[model samples]
Target: MADVAAKERRILVAVDEGDESMHALSWCLSNLISENSKDALLLLYVKPPRAVYSTLDGTGYLFSSDIMAAMDRHGYDVAESVLEKAKRMCKDLHDVKVESIIEDGDPRDVICQMTQRLGVDVLVMGSRGYGLIKRAFLGSVSNHCAQNVKCPVLIVKKPKSTVANN
Candidate 1:
Protein backbone atom coordinates (compact mmCIF):
# COMPACT_ATOMS: atom_id res chain seq x y z
CA MET A 1 0.00 0.00 0.00
CA ALA A 2 1.16 3.49 -0.79
CA ASP A 3 2.09 5.61 2.20
CA VAL A 4 -0.57 8.19 3.04
CA ALA A 5 0.09 11.39 4.95
CA ALA A 6 -2.35 13.42 6.97
CA LYS A 7 -3.36 16.63 5.28
CA GLU A 8 -2.40 19.84 6.99
CA ARG A 9 -5.36 22.12 7.65
CA ARG A 10 -5.94 25.59 9.02
CA ILE A 11 -9.18 25.74 11.02
CA LEU A 12 -10.62 29.02 12.21
CA VAL A 13 -13.08 29.16 15.11
CA ALA A 14 -14.99 32.35 15.91
CA VAL A 15 -15.43 32.79 19.65
CA ASP A 16 -17.45 35.25 21.72
CA GLU A 17 -18.82 35.74 25.25
CA GLY A 18 -21.71 33.35 24.70
CA ASP A 19 -21.65 29.78 26.03
CA GLU A 20 -22.65 28.60 22.56
CA SER A 21 -19.33 29.74 21.08
CA MET A 22 -17.37 28.02 23.82
CA HIS A 23 -19.39 24.87 23.32
CA ALA A 24 -18.56 25.04 19.62
CA LEU A 25 -14.88 25.35 20.45
CA SER A 26 -15.12 22.31 22.70
CA TRP A 27 -16.92 20.37 20.02
CA CYS A 28 -14.29 21.31 17.42
CA LEU A 29 -11.47 20.26 19.73
CA SER A 30 -13.03 16.88 20.30
CA ASN A 31 -14.29 16.06 16.83
CA LEU A 32 -12.18 17.93 14.26
CA ILE A 33 -8.65 17.79 15.67
CA SER A 34 -6.74 14.56 15.24
CA GLU A 35 -3.73 13.20 17.12
CA ASN A 36 -0.34 14.05 15.58
CA SER A 37 -1.93 15.91 12.68
CA LYS A 38 -0.63 19.20 11.32
CA ASP A 39 -3.61 21.41 12.01
CA ALA A 40 -3.59 25.05 13.04
CA LEU A 41 -6.54 26.30 15.06
CA LEU A 42 -7.23 30.02 15.21
CA LEU A 43 -9.49 31.63 17.81
CA LEU A 44 -11.08 34.89 16.67
CA TYR A 45 -12.96 37.45 18.77
CA VAL A 46 -14.69 40.34 17.01
CA LYS A 47 -15.43 43.48 18.97
CA PRO A 48 -18.38 45.57 17.88
CA PRO A 49 -17.74 49.14 16.79
CA ARG A 50 -18.19 51.83 19.39
CA ALA A 51 -21.51 53.63 19.41
CA VAL A 52 -21.40 56.99 17.67
CA TYR A 53 -23.90 59.06 19.60
CA SER A 54 -25.16 62.07 17.71
CA THR A 55 -24.49 65.37 19.40
CA LEU A 56 -27.69 66.85 17.92
CA ASP A 57 -29.93 64.29 19.58
CA GLY A 58 -33.04 65.70 21.22
CA THR A 59 -32.25 64.11 24.60
CA GLY A 60 -29.18 66.41 24.89
CA TYR A 61 -27.47 63.88 27.16
CA LEU A 62 -23.82 63.55 26.30
CA PHE A 63 -21.38 60.90 27.50
CA SER A 64 -18.34 62.15 29.37
CA SER A 65 -14.85 61.28 28.15
CA ASP A 66 -14.28 59.21 31.26
CA ILE A 67 -17.38 57.16 30.57
CA MET A 68 -16.28 56.57 26.97
CA ALA A 69 -12.86 55.45 28.20
CA ALA A 70 -14.48 53.10 30.66
CA MET A 71 -16.63 51.62 27.93
CA ASP A 72 -13.57 51.01 25.75
CA ARG A 73 -11.78 49.39 28.66
CA HIS A 74 -14.73 47.12 29.26
CA GLY A 75 -14.64 45.99 25.65
CA TYR A 76 -10.97 45.18 25.92
CA ASP A 77 -11.51 43.24 29.12
CA VAL A 78 -14.26 41.18 27.56
CA ALA A 79 -12.11 40.31 24.55
CA GLU A 80 -9.26 39.25 26.80
CA SER A 81 -11.48 37.09 28.99
CA VAL A 82 -13.10 35.34 26.04
CA LEU A 83 -9.78 34.65 24.33
CA GLU A 84 -8.28 33.31 27.57
CA LYS A 85 -11.17 30.91 28.02
CA ALA A 86 -10.77 29.63 24.46
CA LYS A 87 -7.02 29.16 24.88
CA ARG A 88 -7.59 27.11 28.01
CA MET A 89 -9.78 24.72 26.08
CA CYS A 90 -6.93 23.94 23.66
CA LYS A 91 -4.20 23.72 26.28
CA ASP A 92 -4.23 19.93 26.41
CA LEU A 93 -3.90 19.49 22.67
CA HIS A 94 -0.15 19.57 22.11
CA ASP A 95 -0.14 18.46 18.52
CA VAL A 96 -2.40 21.14 17.09
CA LYS A 97 -1.02 24.65 16.93
CA VAL A 98 -3.34 27.35 18.29
CA GLU A 99 -3.48 31.11 17.87
CA SER A 100 -5.80 33.98 18.87
CA ILE A 101 -6.83 37.18 17.13
CA ILE A 102 -8.97 40.20 18.10
CA GLU A 103 -10.60 42.45 15.54
CA ASP A 104 -13.13 45.29 15.65
CA GLY A 105 -16.14 45.24 13.34
CA ASP A 106 -19.38 43.39 12.71
CA PRO A 107 -18.86 39.70 13.45
CA ARG A 108 -20.47 38.60 10.20
CA ASP A 109 -18.16 40.64 7.98
CA VAL A 110 -15.06 40.15 10.08
CA ILE A 111 -15.43 36.38 10.17
CA CYS A 112 -15.85 36.06 6.43
CA GLN A 113 -12.91 38.36 5.76
CA MET A 114 -10.66 36.53 8.19
CA THR A 115 -11.43 33.15 6.69
CA GLN A 116 -10.50 34.41 3.25
CA ARG A 117 -7.47 36.38 4.38
CA LEU A 118 -6.08 33.53 6.43
CA GLY A 119 -7.00 30.89 3.84
CA VAL A 120 -8.64 28.66 6.39
CA ASP A 121 -9.67 25.12 5.48
CA VAL A 122 -12.86 25.28 7.45
CA LEU A 123 -14.78 27.91 9.41
CA VAL A 124 -16.31 26.80 12.69
CA MET A 125 -18.85 28.71 14.76
CA GLY A 126 -21.88 28.23 17.02
CA SER A 127 -25.55 28.83 16.31
CA ARG A 128 -27.45 31.09 18.72
CA GLY A 129 -30.72 29.21 17.94
CA TYR A 130 -32.49 32.48 17.31
CA GLY A 131 -36.12 32.42 16.24
CA LEU A 132 -37.03 33.69 12.79
CA ILE A 133 -38.08 37.13 13.98
CA LYS A 134 -35.07 37.56 16.24
CA ARG A 135 -32.68 36.36 13.57
CA ALA A 136 -34.30 38.65 11.04
CA PHE A 137 -33.99 41.67 13.29
CA LEU A 138 -30.57 41.01 14.79
CA GLY A 139 -29.13 39.16 11.81
CA SER A 140 -27.42 35.79 12.17
CA VAL A 141 -23.64 35.82 12.02
CA SER A 142 -23.40 32.10 11.39
CA ASN A 143 -25.95 32.32 8.61
CA HIS A 144 -24.12 35.20 6.97
CA CYS A 145 -20.75 33.50 7.12
CA ALA A 146 -22.19 30.22 5.92
CA GLN A 147 -23.54 31.88 2.80
CA ASN A 148 -20.62 34.22 2.08
CA VAL A 149 -17.41 32.34 2.85
CA LYS A 150 -15.71 30.13 0.30
CA CYS A 151 -14.66 27.42 2.71
CA PRO A 152 -16.88 24.91 4.41
CA VAL A 153 -18.65 26.26 7.48
CA LEU A 154 -19.48 24.10 10.45
CA ILE A 155 -22.12 25.63 12.71
CA VAL A 156 -22.38 23.76 15.99
CA LYS A 157 -25.60 24.25 17.90
CA LYS A 158 -25.55 23.65 21.64
CA PRO A 159 -28.38 21.43 22.72
CA LYS A 160 -30.55 22.79 25.49
CA SER A 161 -30.25 20.91 28.77
CA THR A 162 -33.34 19.11 29.96
CA VAL A 163 -34.51 18.83 33.57
CA ALA A 164 -35.84 15.56 34.91
CA ASN A 165 -39.30 15.62 36.50
CA ASN A 166 -41.09 13.10 38.64
Candidate 2:
Protein backbone atom coordinates (compact mmCIF):
# COMPACT_ATOMS: atom_id res chain seq x y z
CA MET A 1 0.00 0.00 0.00
CA ALA A 2 2.82 2.38 0.88
CA ASP A 3 4.62 1.59 -2.35
CA VAL A 4 1.51 2.19 -4.35
CA ALA A 5 0.88 5.46 -2.58
CA ALA A 6 4.48 6.57 -2.98
CA LYS A 7 4.64 5.98 -6.70
CA GLU A 8 4.02 9.16 -8.67
CA ARG A 9 1.41 8.86 -11.38
CA ARG A 10 -0.03 11.09 -14.03
CA ILE A 11 -3.75 10.76 -14.67
CA LEU A 12 -5.34 12.69 -17.49
CA VAL A 13 -9.05 13.51 -17.47
CA ALA A 14 -10.46 14.93 -20.69
CA VAL A 15 -13.26 17.40 -20.07
CA ASP A 16 -15.72 19.45 -22.09
CA GLU A 17 -18.98 21.40 -21.61
CA GLY A 18 -20.97 18.21 -21.18
CA ASP A 19 -22.05 17.00 -17.75
CA GLU A 20 -20.77 13.54 -18.55
CA SER A 21 -17.12 14.68 -18.55
CA MET A 22 -17.54 16.51 -15.28
CA HIS A 23 -19.18 13.44 -13.79
CA ALA A 24 -16.22 11.37 -14.92
CA LEU A 25 -13.78 13.77 -13.22
CA SER A 26 -15.75 13.58 -9.98
CA TRP A 27 -15.81 9.80 -10.17
CA CYS A 28 -12.06 9.65 -10.84
CA LEU A 29 -11.31 11.77 -7.79
CA SER A 30 -13.47 9.61 -5.59
CA ASN A 31 -12.37 6.20 -6.81
CA LEU A 32 -8.98 6.43 -8.52
CA ILE A 33 -7.11 9.29 -6.85
CA SER A 34 -5.75 9.13 -3.32
CA GLU A 35 -5.43 12.26 -1.21
CA ASN A 36 -2.06 11.23 0.20
CA SER A 37 -0.54 10.03 -3.03
CA LYS A 38 1.79 12.04 -5.25
CA ASP A 39 -0.54 12.09 -8.17
CA ALA A 40 -0.86 14.69 -10.91
CA LEU A 41 -4.37 15.30 -12.14
CA LEU A 42 -4.41 16.81 -15.60
CA LEU A 43 -7.59 18.41 -16.92
CA LEU A 44 -7.60 18.63 -20.70
CA TYR A 45 -10.13 20.54 -22.82
CA VAL A 46 -9.90 20.32 -26.59
CA LYS A 47 -11.38 23.06 -28.72
CA PRO A 48 -12.52 21.91 -32.13
CA PRO A 49 -11.13 23.75 -35.12
CA ARG A 50 -13.31 26.54 -36.37
CA ALA A 51 -15.18 25.88 -39.61
CA VAL A 52 -13.81 27.52 -42.72
CA TYR A 53 -16.42 29.68 -44.36
CA SER A 54 -15.96 30.56 -48.00
CA THR A 55 -17.96 33.00 -50.10
CA LEU A 56 -17.27 30.85 -53.17
CA ASP A 57 -19.20 27.93 -51.80
CA GLY A 58 -22.64 29.57 -52.05
CA THR A 59 -23.15 32.31 -49.50
CA GLY A 60 -22.24 35.68 -50.99
CA TYR A 61 -21.29 37.01 -47.56
CA LEU A 62 -17.68 36.40 -46.64
CA PHE A 63 -16.64 35.97 -43.01
CA SER A 64 -15.04 39.16 -41.82
CA SER A 65 -11.86 39.24 -39.72
CA ASP A 66 -13.92 40.60 -36.81
CA ILE A 67 -16.27 37.62 -36.97
CA MET A 68 -13.39 35.16 -37.04
CA ALA A 69 -11.72 36.91 -34.10
CA ALA A 70 -14.93 36.80 -32.09
CA MET A 71 -15.35 33.12 -32.82
CA ASP A 72 -11.79 32.43 -31.63
CA ARG A 73 -12.39 34.42 -28.47
CA HIS A 74 -15.55 32.48 -27.76
CA GLY A 75 -13.67 29.22 -28.06
CA TYR A 76 -11.01 30.47 -25.65
CA ASP A 77 -13.67 31.57 -23.18
CA VAL A 78 -15.32 28.16 -23.25
CA ALA A 79 -12.00 26.42 -22.63
CA GLU A 80 -11.28 28.66 -19.68
CA SER A 81 -14.73 28.13 -18.21
CA VAL A 82 -14.45 24.37 -18.44
CA LEU A 83 -10.95 24.36 -16.94
CA GLU A 84 -12.06 26.60 -14.10
CA LYS A 85 -14.95 24.33 -13.25
CA ALA A 86 -12.67 21.32 -13.26
CA LYS A 87 -10.16 23.11 -11.05
CA ARG A 88 -12.90 23.97 -8.56
CA MET A 89 -13.73 20.29 -8.34
CA CYS A 90 -10.11 19.58 -7.40
CA LYS A 91 -9.87 22.38 -4.82
CA ASP A 92 -10.20 19.87 -2.00
CA LEU A 93 -7.31 17.80 -3.23
CA HIS A 94 -4.46 19.20 -1.16
CA ASP A 95 -1.85 16.60 -1.91
CA VAL A 96 -2.47 15.90 -5.57
CA LYS A 97 -1.28 18.50 -8.03
CA VAL A 98 -3.77 19.73 -10.61
CA GLU A 99 -2.97 21.23 -13.99
CA SER A 100 -5.21 22.42 -16.83
CA ILE A 101 -4.41 22.44 -20.54
CA ILE A 102 -6.38 23.76 -23.49
CA GLU A 103 -5.60 22.48 -26.95
CA ASP A 104 -7.22 23.13 -30.31
CA GLY A 105 -7.95 20.12 -32.52
CA ASP A 106 -10.35 17.23 -32.88
CA PRO A 107 -11.10 15.76 -29.46
CA ARG A 108 -10.28 12.19 -30.47
CA ASP A 109 -6.91 12.98 -32.00
CA VAL A 110 -5.82 15.56 -29.47
CA ILE A 111 -6.74 13.31 -26.54
CA CYS A 112 -4.79 10.37 -27.91
CA GLN A 113 -1.76 12.53 -28.67
CA MET A 114 -1.78 14.19 -25.26
CA THR A 115 -1.89 10.89 -23.41
CA GLN A 116 1.17 9.60 -25.22
CA ARG A 117 3.02 12.91 -25.12
CA LEU A 118 2.31 13.36 -21.42
CA GLY A 119 3.15 9.70 -20.72
CA VAL A 120 0.03 9.30 -18.66
CA ASP A 121 -0.27 6.25 -16.48
CA VAL A 122 -4.02 6.25 -16.82
CA LEU A 123 -6.57 8.10 -18.96
CA VAL A 124 -9.95 9.00 -17.54
CA MET A 125 -12.90 10.32 -19.53
CA GLY A 126 -16.68 10.25 -19.68
CA SER A 127 -19.01 8.12 -21.77
CA ARG A 128 -21.66 10.13 -23.60
CA GLY A 129 -23.96 7.06 -23.53
CA TYR A 130 -24.74 7.34 -27.21
CA GLY A 131 -26.79 4.49 -28.65
CA LEU A 132 -25.47 2.06 -31.23
CA ILE A 133 -26.66 3.98 -34.26
CA LYS A 134 -25.67 7.35 -32.89
CA ARG A 135 -22.26 6.09 -31.79
CA ALA A 136 -21.69 4.53 -35.17
CA PHE A 137 -22.48 7.72 -37.05
CA LEU A 138 -20.87 10.18 -34.60
CA GLY A 139 -18.06 7.93 -33.42
CA SER A 140 -16.98 7.56 -29.80
CA VAL A 141 -13.93 9.36 -28.40
CA SER A 142 -13.62 7.01 -25.46
CA ASN A 143 -13.78 3.96 -27.67
CA HIS A 144 -11.10 5.34 -29.97
CA CYS A 145 -8.77 6.26 -27.14
CA ALA A 146 -9.28 2.91 -25.45
CA GLN A 147 -8.19 1.11 -28.59
CA ASN A 148 -5.26 3.44 -29.34
CA VAL A 149 -3.65 4.54 -26.11
CA LYS A 150 -1.07 2.41 -24.34
CA CYS A 151 -2.07 3.47 -20.85
CA PRO A 152 -5.02 2.14 -18.95
CA VAL A 153 -8.19 4.01 -19.86
CA LEU A 154 -11.09 4.50 -17.51
CA ILE A 155 -14.40 5.49 -19.08
CA VAL A 156 -16.90 6.59 -16.46
CA LYS A 157 -20.53 6.43 -17.48
CA LYS A 158 -22.78 8.82 -15.60
CA PRO A 159 -25.68 6.86 -14.24
CA LYS A 160 -29.19 8.02 -15.03
CA SER A 161 -31.16 9.14 -12.02
CA THR A 162 -33.81 6.63 -11.05
CA VAL A 163 -37.19 7.79 -9.86
CA ALA A 164 -39.00 5.72 -7.26
CA ASN A 165 -42.41 4.48 -8.33
CA ASN A 166 -45.21 5.82 -6.15
Clashing residue pairs in all predictions, respectively, total 0, 0
List per-prediction Cα lDDT, in the order shown: 0.80, 0.81
- In candidate 1, where is summed lDDT lowest over 10 consecutive residues? 51-60
- lDDT tens digits, residue span 83-132, model 2: 99889989988889999999987677899999999999999998762234
Query: What's the TM-score of every candidate structure?
Result: 0.83, 0.84
TM-score of candidate 1 to 2 decimals: 0.83
Q: List the pairs of residues colliding in candidate 1.
A: none
Off by over 4 Å in 2: 1-3, 52-61, 129-138, 162-166
What lDDT does candidate 2 reach at residue 165? Answer: 13
Model 1 spans with C-alpha error above 4 angstroms:
1-5, 52-61, 129-138, 162-166
The residue-by-residue lDDT of candidate 1 on 50-124, one tens digit each, is 642222223324767786688778888999998999998888877788999999876788999999999999999
Query: What TM-score number comes out for model 2?
Result: 0.84
Q: What C-alpha lDDT, on a 0 to 100 scale, does residue 110 get in candidate 2?
A: 91
